[model samples]
Target: MFKSLWLQTAYSRDPYPALDQDVTCDICIIGGGLAGIANAYYLAKEGKDVILVEKDTILAGATGNSTGKLTAQHDFVYAKLLKQFGLDQAKLYYGVNEQAIEFARSFAKEGEIKAADSILYSQTKHGTELLRHEMRAYETLGIPGELGKNSELPIHIDATLTMPNESQIHPVRFGQHLAQLAVEAGARIYEHSDVVLMDLKKRLLAMKSGHEIQFTELILCTHYPIEALRGLQVMKLAVDRSYIVAAEGNMPLQGQYISVDSPKRSIRTAQFDDKTFFLLSGESHTAGAESNTEVHYKRLNTDVQELYHLDTLTNRWSAQDPQTPDLIPYAGIISSSMPYVYLSTGNRKWGLSNSLANARIISDLIVGRDNNASQLYAPDRTGFGSFLLQALKISGLVVTEFTGGHLTRTNAPICTHMGCRTRWNEGDETWDCPCHGSRFRKDGSVLEGPATKPLNLK
Candidate 1:
């Protein structure tokens, strides 16, 4: 297993104290990634007695492994959105992301580092055509972009779409900074607070350490919605894991770049302290679905050699992305079962922008302010026939994995969340669920969840 470059090198600070006693708050935010921290920043700024908890540490989730591109361009998604939904809905998505960029800029005075144009390049003719469609979508959305044939990449591309003035930051530095701001602004933060379950009747969350937190409101931002309530089962989320390699200095990009083709590749560069490194991330596959996980990293290393001729690879890591069927996030009142409870998940690898957008919408809803962005991302969007098909497909996979659990003779552990058979990820040396995306460490301890408990290795 490879350690994340950001986690290993970007930033460090003293850990926050864990919850030692029972406490009550106006709101409780779960998960310590960008989404949860952003919510804490907003709510605490309003002087609400908010408490934030993390199972591990801040940016210890996907945000730490993120590419850190703060662009609205989510790899040729707008064209598909424009086709499926109307121009208005597609435009709304862009508007929300742009708003997120501006919101991120507000903290620029503290830790913002680099701002550059984001370019999405395509290698195939078909992919180039999609770029043109994306250009039209950009025009409709009033987003400044242009489809062209040039790029800063070392590889040849048929076309490129550029979103000007997008930004990237050191996610760890930025996350810790926002957390400090929240702490200074009157929010309480607790680390290593693993929530095992919730008492719906008492409106309290029970921690694994035998402590309880009472809350009038809840916001679950765990990457996989471990707090899955009544309406969560029917939701179809495609969990994908992508790899990243931060190699020692080679050909570096001045701007962010990703391919529109399958087996996607995203290229960006970062400077940590006095040293700079090129971060190449891609080779995405469904969690626990890889025939051999090591091949993904091998392919990435080969691609780097072919593109940049950089033989010095420094670090490698993987992150899971909870993707919604429609490519939009679920970030509002989760369901009718809990109308006042708010949450965010299924960010489709665009977590940075979507996280901010979600935080803004959730904050506005809590403050009882008029919010135009809430309806577009409503979590209860299940009336579509297309979405039904997606749900059925995912449910079929879950059943197959469940059956495999009972039939298989291997010693590999079963997912604690749903008793699904797990596949060993050679690249990360972890057990990943093909069913619902729960992941476990080599010793069967939970890494990412939807699984509150660890596997029974005995």
Candidate 2:
């Protein structure tokens, strides 16, 4: 049930070797997810020598688990962005995402990424009002979209905002293709090369295999920045996990769609091994908030059975997303103090487009090109008034979780990131930290970070 559809049909290649010796490069990238590969692709295209290291194989993180929806219509976010970041920044957000989608179209093979319209619908009156506001924002921003009452979805929807020319792709295949293109452009990629130590000031990193890399520039594209540096990203960003279940059914939805209402439902279609399947996803909660995460899968399965009547469940999986207080990603420089270090994260759940956009932003900054979107996602940007309050609320929750975690009586180990007690997630069978969203394997190895070191079970 926990198998990811994309990973199941993943592009296969012989595993890249771990870093076997010390190396020096013009740029060194951490993490091998879509963001890392995309960064390598663009940076290498500029003829910059790059080395990318991943603890696991490429795309094994959020990219492999993603639904691969590449669209700028991110679940009625335009209205909120307009209200918060103002019109220009909001427009820039949509523009960059659109550019990222076009990049995907240009880069992907014929069938790897397919064109599809994207839709955001709502079932309740409040949701309808939200969509209306979003429609206004779209119009004001010169985004092409229209209001509708119906779609190819089986469930009833009160209103929908449709944006044409969006696309969806096989995340694993596209990432592998990017990796291949990057390698062709003279980029080096290594798998199972866990970065165990780093001296950012010296711009040197040591991997688990004892080999060290020296570079003039460092880019961290890990789902969560493994190194908090001085940015305090652990306090500014919150981690969310969403579940997806793929059912074997010939019936397909017309376009990629998501609901603006509570208990969000995202719908898309996929073809694997000549069999058509539909992906039903939603039920987002904080990473470690739910102990028995299996209930989420059960709820998703129930929704699929009732809505699509697909009983043959093929696969179920979940992806972790880092969310910022202002809802915009932190994609550029980590901090002013560390000028050569860059990190991209907090894409919410729309990493497919945001990752590519962030990679572009970072590559442009490294190559000394002018990118208007850089300030929009700068990690060091101060939060707005409301976002400051939201950030404080998140910090308060972290404090509560930290206090409550220590008071509880359990055999659970403490999280290495912030010492919060870890919770066992039944669905994924990982130890998850409620405080900062760190995850660990059953054998006490780090699965996700903010927590760079493994749990000490002893």
Best by lDDT: 2
Could you tell me which residue pairs clash in candidate 2?
Answer: none
Give per-model TM-scores. Answer: 0.96, 0.98
Q: Compared to the true structure, candidate 2 yields what TM-score?
A: 0.98
For candidate 1, write residues 1-458 as lDDT tens digits: 27777778755578899999999999899999999999999999887899999988888889998888888988878878888788888888888898988887887553445887899899999998888888988888788997897587767789999998888877778778888999999999999999998876577999999999999889989876665576764347878889898788845567899999877999989875777788888988777787478888989999888878888898889888888778888888887778767878889999999998999999888888877778888787665577778877777888877787658726778788877878887778888888888888889888888887888788
lDDT by residue for model 2 (215-283), tens: 999999987677667878767888899999998888866689999998888999986568888998998
**Model 1, runs deviating above 4 Å:** 109-111
Residue 24, model 1: Cα distance from true site in angstroms: 0.4
CA lDDT of each prediction against the hidden true structure:
0.84, 0.89
Q: Evaluated with TM-score, which candidate comes out highest?
A: 2
How many clashing pairs per prediction, in order? 0, 0
306 in model 2: Cα distance from truth in Å? 1.6
